[model samples]
Target: SFHHYETPEDIRSKTMEWIEDFHADTERNATLWTMEKLSKHDGSDPENYPAHVCVMEFVVQVGADTRTFPSWKGHCVTRRNLVHFRGLSIDKNDIRWNEDGFRPLPDLACCLEKEKEYLLQNLETLLHRGGRIVARLKEHLEDQDQSRYTLP
Candidate 1:
């Protein structure tokens, strides 16, 4: 069997589309969807709880054991991609648990592409919201800067 992964550009474009859509909802957008780039350490920090959605690939495998519930020895190649978001930092040691904020992306390439065409048509609206967007982005960067150093 063969699998196909979207190019980084495609993935990024789709992610942006989802974010832009989320931003369109004025009431909901107030919550702030920070972080444009993906991170391995994402969702692991207490300060950054509820990180917005991002895509990542995970490989799962099960041991072959007939007596146990439908076990297999080899890696499970299917359904490797996921839409990760809304993470919580409960236990620092358990990364899997901390980053469990996800939903299986059946088609990784299309997960966030549903409104691409529609968003393209409404680009003007998004552009008009630039002020809010810029403010939020500035806040995000400033937060990063402040968090990098200890004031004490």
Candidate 2:
């Protein structure tokens, strides 16, 4: 899970704490082991078949206070790309334990594209808001200068 903060420093501390807690949790101890295995098997040609299929999960939380401020704006982005098993050959392909061995699915590409689009839309909105705030601030500064200084 990702939690946003008004300042980057605050979020950095929280992120470190979360990492430490995750490492200490016994129930979640296997998370890093699984990730390492996945990394080693990813894109490996002629794989005998991974013992277990892995599904990566992500969570994000955007703080309310940081959402509106121009200077303190923050974003939480997650990207997931589908895994394709084009080279791996398997015998007796069957779904067990609610998990299927690595195999290419036609719909996976479409789903990934949709997710990418959603993230892009969110980033675009943030940029738009930042631009608007900057323009308003510039106008305010100009107005202040006009009122404070007379023609000399």
Task: Please report, in order, the local distance difference test score of every candidate based on alpha carbons.
Answer: 0.28, 0.28
The C-alpha stretches of model 1 lying farther than 4 A from their native spots are 1-7, 32-142, 150-152
lDDT of 2 by residue, 24-123 (tens): 6655533333222323322222144222212222111222222432211111111111111221222233221214422121222334444434433343
Give lDDT tens digits, candidate 1, residues 16-55. Answer: 6655765686764554322332222233442443122221
Q: After superposition, how far is residue 141 of candidate 1 from its true place, in Å?
A: 8.2
In candidate 2, how many Å is residue 132 off?
Answer: 33
Mark the 10 consecutive residues where model 2 has the least summed lDDT: 131-140
Error of model 1, residue 98, in angstroms: 14
TM-score to true structure, per model: 0.23, 0.21
